[model samples]
Target: MAPTTLVLNAGSSSIKFALYRAGDDVSLALRYKGKLDHHAGDVHFRITDAAGRELTAPDAHGHADDPTSALLERLEPLLGDDDIVEVGHRVVHGGPDFVEPVQVDDAILRRLDALSPLAPLHQQIGLAAIRTIMRTRPALRQIACFDTAFHHDMPPVYRNFALPDLGADIRRYGFHGLSFAYIASRLDAHQRRTVVAHLGSGASVCALLDGRSINTSMSFTPLDGLMMATRSGAIDPALVLYLQRTREMCIEAVENLLYHRSGLLGVSGSSADMRTLIGERNAGARQAVAQFCARAAEHMASMMTALRGCDAIVFTGGIGENSPEIRASICDHLAWLGLRLDPVLNASGAGVITCDRSEIVARVIETNEELVIAREVRRLTQSRH
Candidate 1:
């Protein structure tokens, strides 16, 4: 039986997992990938092989009482004879301390749990998964790959706010580091000074200089950046104060408003999914789409300023890779930067979408955060031997 590594990316509603064949060497090959979703109080489990063929039945269900246990039970039969030697997790926040992947222990778990307040939507979910695995499979080794580790070395100018020294804890710690790191690895050597727009439900723009993050749109938390599907994104600090003072909204209520109730859903008054908003003709939907594109373009431009100039603009993430219309709309706003899209190539939805004469090249590259996690896990685990 070959050794395997399991990578888990836990979100607010689901835990996406991938199993990889971990050889004695550095290279890892994917075996299976799937999600454990919690919807309407029911747990659903699904799995697919590396070839994208469904391995589990459509109606496969998980235990509502213990979703993690259900996930293990379902995975057991599929494992055949392969043994899962180590598990890697996508933890959203590493704060100021962790700049690289690290093994998780009780002390490290406590430290991660303390960071939950900073990444309210993701930190807790990831920690819960880690704790569950530790309890159910106590002997199995686990490692944490942080989402903020990529931008941990970003210049202080981009990392600090205007406020007085509030200590090391309160600084601009960017999210989506795993995605950015993967995108960087895929870029051409000549594509230095690139601005990558990771547009999805949780979106952000990042500036890469020589394949390393120099600046990013998110600051301190995921809430500060381009407007996302359900997040308000970069709002004026005074507006938060105003809401609390005159509106008399409590801290929890205000948090709920910005993190869950705002952005596309709040503006459109219906759905948060970009695909849904794109097909609708309602005025609210139209406005929401327009606003999302505009705000995304604006943030991309901001990342360009940090790079002094942009050599290329790469789009990744769900909305960035799939939606040609949205990509065209965003490029239309960036025309001033000498970015001209090849309509035919843009429609193809992959590869270079920029015209031959365009000053700035634009391309669509699908990101693989799970693979990044698996690679890190392999590296850390191998180093011990």
Candidate 2:
């Protein structure tokens, strides 16, 4: 039986997965890509093979007690004779310790849980899935690939905070490292100095020098970067202090406000979804969308400064790949930096959105974080042999 690996990205309300098989060229090739969205109620499971063939298309009424486990069980028959040899989980926060993917064990799991306070929104989900698999499929091998691992080697100038470190492991630990790594892999040699704007619900800008992460907008936690769909990014520290002291809000209340009640949802007073906000004609909606784009642009410009000069800027993630208006808005702000967008191309979602004469080339590339995790699992598994 051929060997396969399953890559899992368990989020708070969704579980994204991909199955990969070792290709003839010794590369891990995606077999099936899927997502299980259980945001409000039912677990809406969907999957498609590499050829765009739908394997399991559950109806909107589908619900499960444990969607992750249910999805894994359903995938068993799809594999036929192929054996799922290992699993790779996308753990968002590595904190101050982890700098690379590691084979999972009881100790590692507990250590990861300790970092929950650092990434309250995302860290626990992946760990929960890992624990489930451990209890149910104890014999199966598992590995953890961190989102912070890619930026772990950043220079002190970019990694350090301004204030003095008072015995706490507090400093920038950039998120979306896997996405940035995949993007960097796709760039050509000439696209050495580049700024990648990963604009999903949780957005951030990363500057890559020769395909290596130099500096990124997301700092300490995923919440510190670009204003996301619900996250208030890079707010004044004094404002948090004011909320705690004057507003009389507890720490938990402050966390909820910053992580869930802020950004587009807070500003627009309607929806956190960019697509929905863009469709609305109200002033609040316009302001929400405008603020998101403006902040993204400002961070991208800062990332360019970190690069000294940017040769190219690539947009990836949900909003970055789909919304041309947002991309155009960000590019417009960088006009002084020689990033000129071709209106027609930008609207059409072309690979190259910038004009031929533009000094900085702008592009839109879809990111595949699953593939990176699959490869990492394969690497670790191979090394163990």
Candidate 3:
């Protein structure tokens, strides 16, 4: 039996884990995959082995109220008697300094700590999970697989802000690096320069050239690109100032509104789930889809400008990969821009979702960020030998 790599992506209320075996291909054929969900209330953890058989069912974690503590306490049983060699974490924001997958140590922890304020809600949970697991097993080797690392190759124009370089360190640190990287590796052979749409609650667009990220819609943070399910993406700073002055809204309050309040949910006054909105025949949902289409069209245009005109467009994530109506609407808006869709191909669930003979290509591709992090974890662990 090969040593296994444990990859974790800890969220505010959930922790997802995937176990992989070490092999010549580095993809440690899958050992198990599972998640502990609803930790803030009734906790449930489930795991399944390589052939998708349930190794463990949704076991209850009846513990104290604290999620982190409860999680650590419950994880003890699942981890014992395991031959896991190293752990890799899906860290949300590594900032500029961590431009690649890195083995976490005291210095790395400090740096991840410093960047927490930029992504207070997401990064801290990942860091806390790392610390919790470390304390549980002090000898375990740990690695931080960044969500921003893949975008580090973007040029200065895409990475920098117009503000003076002194305080501009807080500019254009794209999230979803692993998501985008997975998409880039699988573009259709015909795609030259392409646009990738990662449409979920936390969504953003990226332009790729020869499989490297040339420019992306997200800037400085995930909050700055296309309008997302609940996030107010690409808002003017002046509007933020206006809210501050008129409403007496503090920075934190404004941040919450931008990061958690203003997207399809804000516009539709409906649920954030795109499927829910699409099924209901209400004015709000209609209006929400309209606004979403408009914003996505605008962002796609912006990406085209950045890429000097892309040869293809790919969609991924919850909304991008599944919502056929949303995809059709978005492509309808872009028809004037030369992206013709083949309805047959688009509906067949083929890996290629675009229409025939379209000038600019479009398709739906599955993204596997956890798998990417697993690969990196395995690489770093092997190098330790």
| lDDT, residue 24, candidate 1 | 72
lDDT of 1 at 297: 97
lDDT scores for all predictions? 0.92, 0.89, 0.79
TM-score of 2: 0.96
- Number of backbone collisions per candidate: 1, 1, 6
Clashing pairs in 2: 172-220
- State the lDDT of candidate 2 residue by residue for 239-271, as single tens digits: 999999999999999999999999899999999
Across 1-112, the per-residue lDDT of candidate 1 in tens digits comes to 9999999988777778899998879899899998888776688877899999987565446466566667777777778899988999999999999999999999999999
lDDT of 3 by residue, 180-212 (tens): 889888876668788888888788888888788
- Order candidates by TM-score, high to low: 1, 2, 3
Between prediction 2 and prediction 3, the one with superior TM-score is 2
Candidate 3 TM-score, C-alpha based: 0.91
Clashing pairs in 3: 21-28, 171-220, 172-219, 172-220, 341-355, 342-355
Highest lDDT: give the candidate number.
Answer: 1
Better of 1 and 3 by TM-score: 1
Ranking by lDDT: 1, 2, 3
